[model samples]
Target: MNTIEVKNLNFYYGNFQALKDIGIAFQEKIITALIGPSGCGKSTLLRCLNRMNDLIEGVKISGEVDFKDKNIYSKNIDVVELRRHVGMVFQRPNPFPLSVFDNVVYGLKVHGVTQAFRLEEIVERSLKATGLWDEMKDKLNSIATELPLEQQQRLCMARLVAIEPEVILMDEPCSALDPIATAKIEELMFELKKKYTIVIVTHNMQQAARVSDCCGFMLLGELIEFGTTSKIFTSPDNQKTQDYITGRFG
Candidate 1:
């Protein structure tokens, strides 16, 4: 089933239109990758899924981004609560300058989950879910920023999972990691998709192909094509998608 749907979505940064009449549906408990060259609005559309664009001044958006059958752009929506259900992991590992335990419990603390036992339970479960518990259990008190790049990235994912979000948005989540680390994160993505609906904006076509069940190709602020990853990679109906996939042009 579809967890989120974008219909005729448009976005503008001041006078420049960033997303143009986009439409796509993200399925539940699966990985959906949006791939494109830089500045093609892939990130913009990712931000729109949880109203992250609202933070920017002079930005305008129209059309519907429906999460669980309700339009997220509707005036009645609570953006903070919306964000809780649709969490985001940025392009870089952005673990706060805090201890690993603190980072894992940060969102829960924000939402007023103060019971020590509950917090500990969540921390353990979240870290285990991201395959970090064995490595991090002894180091919960260690400063998060002091960890290796891969661990930090996994910690960031742990932080998000702690909040129990229904959908996770990852913006080039493995861009900063080495090949081995990237492979680990891709494996984690497979495990994560068994629980949360995942939407990733990736510049790496190969990464998208490896991790996503479905893929969308965007260019010049438009979604040129979207389909099953196998079809998009091997037999895309659109020439633009075929060209982009074949590296003829990006």
Candidate 2:
């Protein structure tokens, strides 16, 4: 039931090591939250899964990220294809300036899906999957950025879903939303796990506790502890994890 198995993962930004000897396995069809304080390498590790780090300059990585039995770092691997299967949603709601319909089908369009009927069906399906269809169906041609924050974030997620990704990586997905919007996103995260393996890097401890099936506690650049959400929150095996969860110190 493991979707991703990362072994001895090490990453460097220039000469500074951002991740050190990290090893972890993410379960399939569940939400795994990586929680830590700011600048703790949680986001760096999340980006490594789908090779987003490749876009950064002066970066080096050494590890085996076996995703669906294929080494993601293999020389012949196609990053675009890899990213198509492993989608990402950023901290902020970054909808394209295009219409809601365009935003939803943008991925499909980029991948050469141009049939009008198929595109329309995908837009409806993806939007409905993310709970945006009912609200935005009438305003399909409206500008994406003009929507509310919650709808915008959901639209971003709907866009990802349109491509039928197997895994979704979210970096502080609810950070920019208000309380109500955050709650809606959290609910959406819960629903998404049934179909896609979700990995989320979140600073919000309560949100992590509520949405994730499993949790990993990171410190500095290492995974201090990882286990079921109940166990991690109630009785962590490591003192660092306990201290972090108890608010003694992050």
Candidate 3:
């Protein structure tokens, strides 16, 4: 079933339009990748899913972004609670400059999870979900920033999982990692998708093909085509999608 739906969506930055009348539905417990060249509004659309764009000054958005059948842009919605249900992971690993344990339990604490036992349970579960528990269990007290980039990225995912979000938004999540690390993260994505709806904005076409069940191709602030990953990569109906996929142009 669809977990989030966007209909007639438009977004602007001051005077310039960034997203043009976009429409798409993200299915639950699956990976959806948005792929395009730089500055095509893929990231802008990703931010819109959870109203992250509201943080920018002079930004305006219209149309409906429905999460669980409710329009997220509606005035009655609580941005904080919406964000809790739809968590985001940035392009880079952004672990807090705290201990590993602290980083994993940070969100839980923020939402009033004060019981020590509950926090510990979540920390263990989250780390294991991200495949970090075995490696990180002994180093819980170590500073998060001191870990390797791969571990830091995994820790960020663990942090998000700790909050038990229903949907996960990843913006170029593997851009900073090495090939081996990227592979590991892709494997983790597969595992995570069994429980959460995942939307990723990626510049890497191959990564999108390998990890996403469905894919959307965007260019110049418009989504040119969206379909199953197999169809989009092999037999796309749109010439633009075919060209982009074949590397004829991006």
lDDT tens digits, residues 75-115, model 3?
99999999999999998899999999999999999999989
Model 1 clashing residue pairs (backbone):
none
> Weakest 10 consecutive residues, lDDT, candidate 1?
241-250
Q: lDDT per residue, candidate 1, 1-250, as tens digits?
A: 9999999999999999999999999999999999999999999999999988888999998899999999999999999999999999988899999999999999999999999999999999999999999999999999999999999999999999999999999999999999999999999999999889999999999999999999999998999999999999999999989898899986
- What TM-scores do the predictions have? 0.99, 0.98, 0.99
**What is the full ranking by TM-score, best candidate first?**
3, 1, 2
lDDT by candidate, in order shown: 0.95, 0.94, 0.96
Off by over 4 Å in 3: none
Query: Which stretches of model 2 miss by more than 4 angstroms?
Result: none
Weakest 10 consecutive residues, lDDT, candidate 2?
184-193
Q: Model 2, range 129-175, lDDT digits (tens) per residue?
A: 99998998899999999999889999999999999999999999999
Q: What residue pairs clash in candidate 3, if any at all? A: none
Q: What's the true lDDT of residue 166 in model 3?
A: 99
